[model samples]
Target chain A: MERCRELVRPALVEAVGRLHPWTGEMAAYALGWADTAGNPDPGGSEGKGVRQALTVLGAEAVGADGRDAVPGAVAVELVHTFSLLHDDIMDADTLRRQRPAVWKAYGTGPAVLAGDALLAQAVTVLAEAPNPRAAAAVRHLCRTLNALVSGQAQDLRFEHRPWNGPGAVGPEQYRSMAEHKTGALLGSAIALGAILGGAPDETVTALERAGRHLGLAFQAVDDILGIWGDPAVTGKPTHGDLRQRKKTYPILTALADSGRAAHELAALLDSPQRIDGEAAGRAAALVEEAGGRAATRDEARRHLDTAHRTLRDVPLTRTAAQELDTLFTHLLDRTW
Target chain B: MERCRELVRPALVEAVGRLHPWTGEMAAYALGWADTAGNPDPGGSEGKGVRQALTVLGAEAVGADGRDAVPGAVAVELVHTFSLLHDDIMDADTLRRQRPAVWKAYGTGPAVLAGDALLAQAVTVLAEAPNPRAAAAVRHLCRTLNALVSGQAQDLRFEHRPWNGPGAVGPEQYRSMAEHKTGALLGSAIALGAILGGAPDETVTALERAGRHLGLAFQAVDDILGIWGDPAVTGKPTHGDLRQRKKTYPILTALADSGRAAHELAALLDSPQRIDGEAAGRAAALVEEAGGRAATRDEARRHLDTAHRTLRDVPLTRTAAQELDTLFTHLLDRTW
Candidate 1:
């Protein structure tokens, strides 16, 4: 991972820098560089740079040269950054990575433009690759990009009120949103690597599907941590999900259970900001007591199992499979 | 012109309706239909819709099936609407087309989302075209779309303060900004027409260049009217540009020529609101005295000439070329 990180950062910077010549400053800010003043401010500043790493790792795992994957690395990172910029604006959270969000910092006018530049450049840069295969990647990327935005719109709509009319968000609905928001991009990341490598179509599909499963597990874990993770570790406020009243899987499970704990959770949700420290602690305990936490864990584990199975079944070399295995397992096994 | 408007309005509405699966409220609002609350409170509101008409006309000029250009028409209109939504927000303009702007009516968040949705659906709908040609349209439209945003950024940046520094914004900078702000999409409108009509590359290039020039002429005439036209005639405020203090070509030209009038003009520009109606009238007279309006007209005429030249060069029936010539001439010939 460290080796991959070192290889991809400069390229990520180059790609983002080359993105919007007019709006490039906003793109730079998207990468956690500055606040348009060129001041070195840290606000969880650097992205995990995980998407670029995913591209390179996907390439290496498929027995393709890492150098061949550079374009794909740049492409994936551009999509990822654009998604973050736009989503931050749509969510209206005002803070991203603990910094004033782009929309908040420069105002929504420029933040949206900055995000627009990223998406436009992603296609432009991909078109630069002299491979006919690049067209397929571009096509798939556009579809995924559209899905990402659609999912976000749907998710934002969910926040306006209790969706499905007074019931917890169902697990299937959670999966659908996760698929569009997180898994679609992840699948595109893996698919990009395979197509750039000239891997067979079947293997490409498997890797993409594996990525989807991994993304689902990743988000499920994220949801669990959103409610219960320590701020010291998560860098997010305690009960941040409760604060937003986000309908993550665990909370949904608790709400749908229709028991004493469920009733208490509903009461907490009805009164915005009513979930105080003790109330939050009690709510978390009730959620776990009502099997919500366990249910979420089981769903995540199921997806992780599917990802591993797909990785094994994908018709790639043993080494390729092993690299993917390493990445997915580590993603699922994160403790904080 | 009535026939063109008839062809464009319903088609534009239907295309935008396919975008978010939501009701046609935003599109309707933009189209000057129902109000923000979905009431049928419409008597006035309509943009030039010139971009959409151009797409259809460009296709017709090729003697190709006009329906083939529908995706391009929809895509360009949506991109144009997105720009209007964001532009109104950035400009802090309260109204558009004698009605509330999208941001004003829908609130900032939904207006932004609506714009984002429009843009996303623009790409998605283009991608959905039944041929690879539609994909190419997507490719060109995305680039055009980016440039549009960049242009808006430049326009917004310039709005923050005066361009009191060096260089005559000249024909070149104005041309560049106009091309990005409006021309590229018009060019896309034409090129996509040629593509959808299966016109050859040379013809497409000619159409595109023609569209660029037409766009410049369009904006120049707009800038001219923004200041000089009667409010009753133009259906906008007289000296609107002066009120906006827009550093358009005429103003820039006036500013570039040094004199007492130029100094007074600059003073009025520095504090546009402080300038009385008499002072504003004096400023416009001084701008004319400084050869501002004449220089702008000359530039507009130059572009119109180039646009006609490109139209003549393209391999088409003389009648089709003449039709385009008439359209360009009418656009440049707008009185108010």
Candidate 2:
């Protein structure tokens, strides 16, 4: 992961440097390289670079140098950051990476333009890459963007749906939304790496499938953390998703159960009163009583198993495969 | 132009149809195919399709059928629509095509997602096009997106600068912003059409230059209309830009002159009070007295002449060239 970050950092910086100076500063701030005041961050509070690691590992697994996938890594990271910037506004998320969100630091208008600049830079970087598969990479990125937008639309629409009645969000719907919202980009990262590394179509497809499964596992874990993780560890308040009435995996699973606890939780959620701290605590207990916690954990484990099986089935360089296994385990085995 | 619209309409509709139902509805609304209720608009308050016309004409001028550039035309129109939707949110403009802007009708978050969906679709449409130069076309579109974002950033930044100071926006800066915000896509529309039609690089470059000049001319005329045109004709309130304190061409030109009228106009604009109807009327007279009106007209004519000269020098199909000339004249000669 560190190696991947090193390979991607310079190119990502250069790509963002092409934006208008005002927006470029906002992009840098959003990426955690700079603070709101445009001062360089000595602590280097950048992202975990999981997508970058996936891209680099996918390339190495295909018997190519990790550096060969640097462009893909940078492109995926840019797209991820772009989505974060825009999503902060859409979701009204006040904080990101333990700091005020881009829209909060700058105004909504500037944040929107900054996000746009990053997205454009993502496409431009891919299109200008010297790799022979650059065109296919751009196509894959565009398709991923389409999926991301669709997922966001679904998530927003889910906000207005009934809590438990006719229009209630179901497990299948939640999975579909999560797959589009989270899986598409992860899948594209691996696929882009493999494609740019000259992997066969079958290999790329298999790797992408594995990446999708990993994404589902990741989202399941994130939903768990959203409700119960330590604030210091997660960089978010406990029950944040519940407060927002987000249709996350655990909540949807809890709602799917037919039980007294499920009905009580539904009634609580459907109430006109805001989900205050005490209500959120009670709701969290009710969710657990309805077997939401166990179900969510089981779902995460299942996806992780499937991802492992998929990875095992694919032919990859021996050392790189081991490294990928370690990375997956590190990412999904988080207590927070 | 009608022929170009005919070729592009179905493809454009189909491209937008690929978005999630909720955002697709908003995208349709933004494109003027639907109203606030998501019902189809019988009046079809669609844009003039000038970019689409330029694209098809560019193809024809390079000896290809207009139909050959449908993908390029559709891509440009989608990109243009995307910009309008986002720009309305950034500018807080409530109206588009005599209807509520997408953000006004669907909320800011939905509008942002809808704009994003259209942008993704634009790239996807170009990438999936059957044209041999589709890859080049995608690259051109991405570069144009970068320019558009930069232009928007510059425009937003201009709003914060002092009206008259070292950091004040100059005519050169305005021209650069206008070229990026308006000319980049227009130039790309023509360039993509030519490239997709397999025109030589030199011809594509020449055609793009002509398109840029036309874009500048178009923007100058729009600036004139923004300040002086009838609301019934322009589909906007009189002095709409002035009311917003927008650094438009006329206002900037008027402020640049060394004269009593210029100083008076500057003082009026510098005041904290909002420019109401009467003040806008007085400011209009001051602009004309300061030579801004004449200078702006002269600027438009100069760009138009340059565009015409570029077109005359280019080697093009005779009938197609004549058709393009007519299209340019018709577009630039608008009274509104």
Candidate 3:
């Protein structure tokens, strides 16, 4: 992952540098390279670069140098940042990476423009790639964008739906939303890398499938952390998702039950009162009592196992495959 | 132009249909095909289809059928709608085509998502084009998006600059902003069509130059209409730009002068009180008295003449060139 970040960062910087200076500053701030005042933040802790790492590792697994997939890695990273910038505005999130969100630091209009700049730069980078499969990469990226937008729309719509009834969000709906919102980009990351690495179509398909399963597992873990994880470890307030009344995976699963705890949880959530600290704590306990926590853990393990099975079945370079396996295992083991 | 719209509308509808239903409804509303209730509005008056017309004409001028550029036309129209949707949110304009803007009708989040959906669809349409130059089309569109973003950022930044000071926006800066915000997309529309039609690179370049000049002329006319045109014809309130204290071409030109009228106009604009209707009328008269109106007319005429000269110099199909010439002439004559 460190090597992948090293390979992707310079190209990413160059792509961002092409933006207008005003938007460039906002983009840099959003990407964690600069502070709100447009000064470099040397101590800034950046994203883990999981998607870019997958791109590089996918290329390496196809017997290509990691460097060959730099453009795809950078493109995916930029798209990821673009989604985050826009998502923050849509969600009204004021903080990102322990600092002000782009929309909070620079007004909404500038943040919107910055997100747009990053998205445009992502496409331009891929279109300008020297690889023969660049067009295919662009198509894949656009499809991923479509899925991302659909997923976001679904998630937003879910917020307005009833907690329980005919129109309430179901577990299946949650899975589909997660698949579109989170899994599509990860799937595209590996597929794009494989394509750029000159891998066969079937190999790219297999890697994409594995990447998607990994994404689902990752999302399941995040849902768990959003509710029960320690704030110190998660870098978020305890029960943050519950306070927001977000229809996350665990809550949806908990509400899926027809038992006493599930009914009580739903009644509490449906109340007009805000979910303050005390209510959030009780809601967390009720979700656990209704088997939401256990069920979510099982779901995560099941998806992780499927991802591992897909990865093992594919014919990949031994060293890169082993590295990817270790990385996936570490992801599930992560506390943050 | 009507033929171009006939070829492009079906394709545009199909492209927008690919979005999530929620976003698709908002996009339809933004495109003036639907009302606030998501119902089709049979009586809705649509845009003039100038950009798409240029695209189709560009393809025909290169010896290809108008249908050959439908994807390019659809792509540019989608992008144009995307810009309008986002611009309404940024500018906080409540009305579009005498109806509530997308952001005003829907919420900001949905409007933003709809704009994003349209932009993504624009690229997808170009990427999925059967033309061999589809990759080039995508690159050109991405570059145009970059310019559009930069222009919007500059426009927003100009709003904060003093009307008369060292950092105030200058005529050159306004020109650059207008070129990027307006000219870049128009240029790309024609260039993409020509590329798809298999025009030589030099012909594509010449046509792009002509389209850019046409765009500048068009923007100048829009500035004039914003201030002095009849409200009924423009479908806006009287002195809308002056009321908002927007730094348009005429306003910028008027502020550049050192005469007494220019000083008085600056004082009126710099006042803390909002410019109501009466004050807006006064500002308009002052702008005209300071020669802003006449200078802006000269600027528009110069650009239109340059565009005509470029068209005359280029080796184009006689019928298609004559059609484009007619369109350009009509644009300046338009009151709205």
**Interface RMSD over true interface Cα atoms for each candidate:** 2.7, 0.7, 0.8
- Model 2 residue B45 CA deviation (Å) reads 0.8
Pairwise DockQ winner, candidates 1 and 3: 3
Clashes of each: 1, 0, 0
Q: Write the per-residue lDDT of candidate 1 for residues A228-267, one digit (tens) a residue.
A: 8878777788877876678888888877786887777777
Clashing pairs in 3: none
TM-score between candidate 2 and the true structure: 0.98
* Local lDDT at B143 for model 1: 73
Q: Compute fnat per model.
A: 0.32, 0.86, 0.75
User: Model 3, DockQ value?
Assistant: 0.83
TM-score of chain B of 1: 0.91
TM-score of each: 0.91, 0.98, 0.98
Which ten contiguous residues of candidate 1 chain B have the minimum total lDDT? B162-171
Quantify all predictions' global Cα lDDT against the true fold: 0.75, 0.89, 0.90
Highest-scoring model, DockQ: 2
The list of candidate 3 runs beyond 4 A from truth reads none
